[model samples]
Target: MDTSRLLRTTGTVLAAAGLLLSGCTTSGSAQRASASAGGATGSGAAHAAPAVPEEPSAALRPYYAQKLRWRECGVPGFECATMKAPLDYAHPSSGQDVELAVARKKATGPGKRLGSLVVNPGGPGGSGIGYLQAYAGIGYPAQVRARYDMVSIDPRGVARSSPVECLTGPRMDAYTQVDQTPDDAAEQAKLVEAFKEFAAGCQERSRRVLPHVSTVEAARDLDLLRGVLGDEKLTYVGASYGTLLGATYADLFPGRAGRLVLDGAMDPTRSAIDLNRDQTAGFETAFRSFARDCAKQAECPLGRGNTDQVAQRLRDFFRTLDAKPVPTGEPARPLGEALATTGVIAALYDESAWPQLREAITQAMDGDGAGLLSLADSYYEREPDGSYANLMYANAAVNCLDQPPAFTGPAAVTAAVPSFEKASPVFGAGFAWASLNCAYWPAKATGTAHRLEAKGAPPIVVVGTTRDPATPYKWAQGLAGQLDSGVLLTYDGDGHTAYGRGSDCIDTAINRYLLEGTTPAAGKKC
Candidate 1:
């Protein structure tokens, strides 16, 4: 899941349901995806850096000056609009432009309008508009919502923004079951073959949209949104991968940057392999937290054993499933090691899902894997009707483009196994192999590891959770140190992002920043 690009919106605790994935995946609502904004870091200048433009170039100015024609969407109070951006920023007049999907809930003023606050629930692929409609508009602090129009944009190659499509439901289903932690050459070949097929599918289906879906391009789209919405500068809150997008936005548009919050941030300085290892360790840390809590429960599935024992038991269970996949109630869609791993990994995003993970693992160990299978389905954004959302396709598209492959081939993965396992003994092997997914990508790497300062940008707030599983806490420290005006707000807690999750201290501080343009002190911890 490199899930350093954490599934923020998918795991978001929704108002009508426990998690958005519970409702967002229905065929009835395609734009309903990013309500779960997810992570931090002072980030980068990849590729020696393009000279920062002091002003929008003449070609780009047209994109910046364009206006949006808002119309009512299916969701009440939310207005939908489509905005245009060049398909390639380097060549704006290429005659190819991307139409982005946007949605906003106008400010419900109690005093005066403060303008728009754009949010992204960090999928790189997740639906920002969906997030705005499902939660941000209603769940954000009342005062904040009252003064600012809650806004979201479906970045190009994401849901409702000409989403990147790949394999059909059935092919994707087969792809998910292929062995990731291969024990033999044959199995390893099959794993690589699956990745090849997935990449090939994306290339075949989304040739035009695939190359332009990088994070840099998405950040450019955010600036475009800022212009059309009439905002003088970008005011944003980005979660998980969204944090990277926001950081990149600030880096690209320093002068145009306003109040920005990057929660559960990614360190742009990290290479793809480093990110995979860091996230692998992060999940292990989170799993230990879940393990400690689970072991104290009377219904604990792994018994009252220590974390190592429990982790061993889980790994053993995965091995058993590898040889004999269990029926998931749906005869055609049985549960295998890959699916079970994804199921468990999905639950690691938020602690609230720990109970569900406990029950699912219990059911899987008892030979009925339907519960675990369902969790895996949710992680992949597979709908009830066997169709899948564009989440994974866009995830891969953006990820592969954002950095070079984690491994070049099976030999490379084999060599890296020891280091990855050292990082996370419980899930390292799988994470290591999963990193191989991008190795076979069709696109050449368009970006590289670099540090971002966003020099001259206004004070930008960076939030980090100490025990965040998908994005580690140290990333926050790194991101804060990198930004010239970065302010660090630490949540000494667990789960993904800090704000709107639970802690009042975290919420109050962020609210002050968003509402009054107040920056938290240099080192504020919740």
Candidate 2:
């Protein structure tokens, strides 16, 4: 597979898991308007409102004034709301409103309510509200849930709100198949063409929405939500890319910070290129862990040997697929490097998925690519009916807007390939180059890399998994170090984030903090 396709696949998977839950809804229009007008007076009373710079445009003023009415939704204890935010923060008066989907499950315990606890599953584009309703809202420790009203909001350009859609199902299907690791000049040209096509499609389909769907803008919009939620201080738990969003919020509104927990944290100081390279190396580390475990298993494909050799073998398989893809169950859809890499990347997120990855690879080696393809399909969030979610589009838009592209073109990618290869030997070159996708983005970035230092914020917890691949453990260390009042909690294990992925020690530490305003030691390791 070519680099672009790999990026599209990875971006798609991350975005889908990140923001799949929230979306725009038409049913709550009247309620939204009434809530906004009714609650405007008390919205800023929870906390000292940040200075509203100048008069906001009439268009954005209404959204800022809007109050979210927590009405009963599908979940038994949770209430949902639809709020509005400005499309462009710079031109807040533009009158172009983007909807934000929100959900909250009220506390059930007898203790006095501490406040709302907002949570996010990272993807720069992840749906905060969706995660709250699906997992965190109901599954969080009963003790923590008892003291806080669990809350979440779908950021701009994400699902359950006004989503930033770029392509139709058919167009996205075609986009996903484009190769990323081109072998020759012709293949390289094909890769460039694929990027152009994807960019052009997004531009044509989402011209109005693309430019405004940036992380910085999303952070500002979050402040608006914080105000509307009537919280004196913003309490949040963010994972993966959500960490970046949370940190951004702290940077933009330090005074509003409350009990924040950033799990599977991201380092805001790294450049896009550096972040990508580090992530590539992290994946290699995770793959080595998988290889070590697989070699002990009876069904090991690469056999019992050095992990380096297993990695090389996997690379060789990818090279072979680059030349000729194998047949999957679907006749028109052959399993190529992009799909194979995606399958591997999916497993790297959680060690629990390692066994499944081993089985998938063993099946692929046996000429049945169905298992691997299924893993890849799950990562991409591909529906059984040949439809796709809008995750990739939103991910690209948010990532591209958060920082500039790592590389400008194929030449830059070629130069970086060797270094990338050195990082992972298996996924390095491809992932390294995959970081360049934003170079062809249709919109300019609205944010830049900057350190987050929430100096006046209350004690915040930052969790790190020692062997996390998606968001490396070092990122957690860095983010914790950067935050003025950050308390580091380490989970000496494998996985993307640490809160609910079955670590009793880790969960207890976080729950204690959330329920009683107690923080773990600065460097407590589980």
Candidate 3:
């Protein structure tokens, strides 16, 4: 579990690989793999396939006290809602409602409304409603926007929806600064204490909400939203951890699935350990890409050389920081391994951030760590005023409830060190050990990893970026393979999710699917 650790590890590996491959121009073969055909034809072809529903569940009641008053928020014609779900689905009649923030932008065209289009921007902890209001609600292709009402809901225990808050502002500051790559017994003990403190904080501050934030419950909440939205079936687009949420929905309500798109998919079958190690490898892959690109640039920090050597140099730099943090202008300005690692992971979310990461690295190399530190802060969603978002707290709560921790003790982490380092020579060791944080989670896991067949579901499009850092490409491959009606769309390039990261081919394909109800061909790459 520990989805944050999983995401962080995944991001690190993909970032490392991306850094290494930055110098090499994408091959024609790669381009072929990345481009896929799009349009209403694909959607029609997919819908013609047989329906499959592996699991069926009862519908959820509307939790709103009064009908929503639809009004504009940020985007033109967008309306927002504040719905409610049970703190625990199994105990829905318990009278305890967890608020779920939602947003909608109605169709804008001459055609009859096809249905509601639900969207989620990963994080297991990311604010779906916020993302909808900020980007997807307005930025999604106009064709898709014209046919369907765009909708988003913040999952339980996430932002603006009865969020799970753990540490206070100052406590969180200390938690973020805790050294992640411990070099000595003292440091290791400190790390363990940090985990304990974090868990304890959640138990103390958000006890009633912590145990019920599992992905399964959130998936159930999605189905409830589907019912309330008056859609006969669910049409959704979820990215990163959002992919996991979508897949879970399919598993739980396969009969209701319709035109689901899971981008940057997460593999539900993988154990916490497997997820962590694989992610380590992914970051190494990304680092190599970045390193290769950096080698050819004038501001290259690791210099022109083999990617492996450059990775080692970066590792060495991390070690140096672990020993003596670098100054960054704040009260506790020096950057430690945790903050540095967070900064590195943030850039892995998008290829467009590669140049900024390079500049951050160059500055850090020259004893100026502010830029990189700032990137880390942004990734952590830490505010400039020293306040913090509830993201990390919610992330930990949900992840802890999804799966058991990979390691229970520092000794186990120590034992796994070599494997972690070998998985990703650049980021393996740190990420491998970071997986242990959830070992001390106050609440026990309430769910287990399982395949999402969605046998009776309509054809679902699963998109994956070959070098996606957060949710590895293999996850998309695995999820598509798992779903009975799944169709795979591959993007043979670097980034987190494919739809809006700047590939016209990708945007076109997804747009065509949403607008026309088509599905991209299996193995189609974009």
Candidate 4:
């Protein structure tokens, strides 16, 4: 997902680990019924693939040998560090370098330490250090926290790590509500201009960093971090987009993978177009689940009706908002269809937020859109003061650099709309158009879709929440099947990620693996 156009993840609080199909309009039928909350079981057939060379080149030896300078920062008990990595690995000899912000909470051990266990809560744009300090530092199971040092690094071009900057607060505000679901040529033209301006602003403000934030570079940075931490191998727990980062690292440094757990996994072999469509379908699946549950309630916003009826009603509401946006308390902003849709999608990540969504929708239906607007604001990381974080900027920078655009222009999107709508009727058109955001990206993509068969790696667990909205369960299944040593752990449940959010079955398996290096049984369902 293009984090820039698609608002994903809250900054410090790792509340929900799900994907939001942003910058798209709401218009999709149920792609699939709600998936079972059970682990996947099938043939463990590995695809024919070459092994990734584990060793780093001699020219880059200095970077791998560099030591981190750590100092106490943020919450007590967590120490922060900084390291410098080559801005471009292809030109390691170049003088250019990018700073990485890292944080660790040393193991509170009574037993032998299990080395550093790095954690990332997706959003290629999410602040790893922020996640470490706010959640993992204190919220991880006590046993896991006591045995292993919890570590994180804000990848290049993310928060506090030489971030990518695009539009200012006011400009970004206007950009979010651009007629994403264009009804005519003029609206489409305006949408294209918005993408162009966003791309141009990123290039203008963050020219140097934009091109270097690809997942490949970020994964390489992880290997460097592993070396500096004095860990011969990398131990990691990554969710959502973080799974892509973890898989890339495992592919790049197979021998270095030490009990990596990729929750909410993405299929490395899939193209950007397929990924967006699959994700669109996932959201539709999730929304249907939400709609079905909503219909059972007396205060249901879409009213007590079947899934299709509820979905159609919501679509109708979106069209109504598109025609005449509801007044949000904020003077400059109105509850337009795009933002309102984002607000609703944000809640679909975790079932815990369903009640909030119900309330927000009820409020929106009642002529007050403040609740829904607040939800949208949270999705965008827009502060009450109106300032925006570097999340969106960095999201685009990394996503665009990681792969070629899914669609090159409005024409291509128009051509692909039918397939997208087929995958997700309500969300298809908007997401099909949203896929074009990267078409106008300033930097060329440095990576391509490929299978990660980390042939020499230790057991690497790939977790999937069957009903995951951002990364569908099938992605996890696909990734596990592709990796040479991947094991599947399924959490047949509601929400984006399975670990830590609440699942003793899932948590126990992960904890045992992280602490004792015990691989969960293949096809383990929680």
Candidate 5:
């Protein structure tokens, strides 16, 4: 999913993850629905296939051998560090470099200290350091934390690094509220302008680092990180879009790849259009699951009826909102179809948030859009002062760089609508239009839709939630199948990711893989 048009997550915050999707709209994140609670933000894939050599050339040897300067930062138990990476790996002699921010929580002793366990909670744009401090550092199982140091890095062009800045908060607010499911040319034009403005803002404010923020480069940084940490290989756990980063790293540095767990994986073989369409279907699948559970409850705000009927009614409500927006307590921000839909998509990242969704829907239906509006704010990671995090800006930068635009223009979106709707009746059109944001991107793509074989890597465990709203389960299957040593661990469950969401089976399998290096038997189902 293009993080610009599609807001998404890692298995989210046990509150913090998941993104929003809208056509031509500068949508906010779809982050990691953390196996515990987070969603992957952007989706990534490469095509044809780039030739990746096993080792860096001698010019880059200095980077691979550079040391990190660690210091105590604001976070309590966490120490921060900075590492220098070539601004352009292909041109090491350019005399320019990017300084990456990193964080770590040293392992709690008792057992012999294992190597660093680096984690990424997706967002192609997500702040890995934020996630490490917010959850992974303290929230992970104690047994695992006792031996391995919890570490993370804010990828280039993301938070704390040289970030990609686009619109101001007020402008973003207007952009997010733009009618995404356009009804006519005028509406479509409004959407198009929003995307154009967003793309222009990126080029104007962040042209320097924007072109260099591809997943392939970020993966290379991981190898540099591995060397700096003094680890023989990279020990890692990545969720949502993080999986794509991890997969890319494994494919590029198969020899340096250590124990890796890619939860809620993305299939690198799909084209950009296919990825957007797949995620539309993924969100629809999750909505059906939510509807089924809602049907059994008397408090269901969507009323009774089957999933299709309820989905139709929900569509009707959105149309109603399209005609008239509702109040959200904040005078400037109202609950319109775009925000309401984003709110719904955000909740779908995790089933635990269903009750909140139900209540929010009920409130919206009652004309008080506050509940749903709050959900949208959370999805966008909007702070109280109306300032925004750099998540959305970096999301578009990385996503557009990873693959060519999914749709080139409004005409292309119109042509693809039927195929997209065939994949998802509820979200097809919006997502198809959403896929167009990249068409306005300033940078040329450095990657394409291709396979990630990681031929010489050790066993890499891939986890999939049966009803993930952002990354479909089929992607997990596809990724595991492509890798020479990929093992698929299936969790017949809800939410965006499979680990840390109270599944002892999923957690145990991953824990063993990271700890004792025990790879679960192929096709293990939890």
Candidate 6:
């Protein structure tokens, strides 16, 4: 089916088995704030601007001064804690609070303790705690993990952090199958209704949480984590959309910024439509790379034709599925175009999934749709029992709040089709339509496109993969150029993220920064 939209735009990678245990909570206690380190740029070069205030404003100081009570989580060597932040930063005394879920693995201590190193795998909705326990804690360099406590905070309205809920399993199933590429007025109306219903469900079930889950608010939450942990400044490693969160934190607290590594960076200056269009083109670039690899395989699903001919063949397959779905072994769940497209797009996140995609597509072409349906299920985080995780729900909530809708309605999307199609001939129309999901959001947009200079912040490393399907590499270059103290670290590779991916150059550059606070030289490429 015609799934061209990259799902990484929504969900983070799933936690490995046995890492979803609930964190135990305790009352917070007071702690003295650590003394700030003055202008310790990795390169020892002076910043273009002066450092910001070491202390927050009187209103925000309380949040920065609060402490957390850590208790043992089920996971070995990990402690879980709950930190409180204002539901509305504008009115901290409103007596309203959002409880954030946090987890940490203390440094093993072969080297001098470097303090906490917070990590986030981006989703706008991904479980930071899950990522910490499953991946970063165990997968990060032993040297880095031995010195700095690996930490994570599930952003507000994500995972255990007051997660936003939307449509029920059955309703969501129907919603996923709704035709994104509307061919007629009736179909377009149906698509609009599905979006409206989804938005309405979020508002109905999560009204109190929906309005405050923006990236700016989440960044504010990160500051609270920093203060409670008794850290002098924020030392962070953020991947994908997590980079956006880290950049926002840098923008808000430049002086308190420590060593920051933003892998798979997003340019904060783009409008919502531009982000979608650029991402659409990114997926096309990634697809061509995948297509070229597939063409050399013994059992290429798209045939041995040139890249353009193969893309057209895949497009034709999606069109065929749009008109007629095939049974995917699940009696009630036939494999339709929308689901198939999502299935295909999900595999584009990392090259390792390429063989799986080829096999899934080959199976689908042979009238067996189960394999592709499974891929789509994985993309949506749909459980075997038909329930769905809050990934998509929180993704839409945070995304809708962070910026205005890319399109006001189907008409706007229709008007933009030519440009989007020009960006990506095979998958452009579906993604352009998908961008309309936020148009019917219940809350008014709370943010806008702006440059994140993070002026005077300590040197921040921005890593970009050359063929990343979600955040394009150019966005990294643009973000690095925008930040006054940004350092560019280009990973001349594929995949959504760069670090800890078997690259000695990338890992060494990042590890040095995280451990020794040494930033890579500008324009360093792996």
Q: CA RMSD for every model?
A: 6.1, 7.0, 8.9, 7.3, 5.8, 6.9
lDDT of 4 by residue, 1-526 (tens): 1222242332243224333322111100010000001112122222322333466676578988888888999589989989999887766777889989999999998899989989887876777887788777888899989989999999899888999999999999998888778998999999999999999999999998887777767777888899889998899988788887788777667778888998888887777788888888888888988998999999898989899999999988989999998888887898888888878777887787788899988888888888888777767778778898787888777777666688887888888899988887667777788788888898876555666777788889999989888888998999899888999999998778788877999999998988888999988898
lDDT of 3: 0.71
lDDT of 6 at 377: 83
lDDT of 4: 0.77
The number of the candidate with the highest lDDT is 5
lDDT by residue (1-526, candidate 3, tens digit) is: 1124434212212223321111000001111111111001111111112222333323233452235656666666778877777775545556888878889988888688899999877666677776776677777777788888989988888888888988888888788888777779998999899889989999998988887777767776787788778788899988777777787777657778888888877777777777777777777777777788878888778778889777778888888887877888886657877788778777765666778888888888788888788777766667778887777887878777677677889999999989988878777777866788889998876444556676777888898888876667887788789888989899889766777766888888887788777777767886
Considering lDDT, which of the candidate structures 3 and 4 is the better prediction for this target?
A: 4
TM-score of each candidate structure, all chains considered together? 0.93, 0.88, 0.88, 0.92, 0.92, 0.91
Worst 10 residues of 4 by lDDT: 27-36
Residue pair clashes in candidate 6: 2-341, 3-341, 3-342
Model 6, C-alpha of 320: deviation from truth (Å): 1.2
List model 1 lDDT by residue over 127-159, tens digit each.
888788877888888999999999999889988
* Ranking of all candidate structures by their lDDT, best first: 5, 1, 6, 4, 3, 2
Per-prediction backbone clash count = 19, 23, 53, 9, 54, 3
Candidate 6 Cα misplacement greater than 4 A, ranges = 1-53, 57-62
Q: State in Å the error of residue 516, model 5.
A: 0.6
lDDT by residue for model 6 (1-526), tens? 2122122422235222111111100000000001012211122111122323567657667777777788998999999988888887656667899999999999998989999999987777778887887778988899999999999999899989999999999999999899998998999999999999999999999999888787767877888889889998999998878888888788768988999998888887777888888888888988998898999988999998789988998999999999998999887788888998887777777777788889989999999998888878877778999998887888888777766778898999999998999999988989889889879999877556666788778899999889988888998998898888999899887667788877899999999988878889978999
Report the error of model 2 at residue 275, Å: 0.8
Least accurate 10 contiguous residues by lDDT in model 5: 27-36
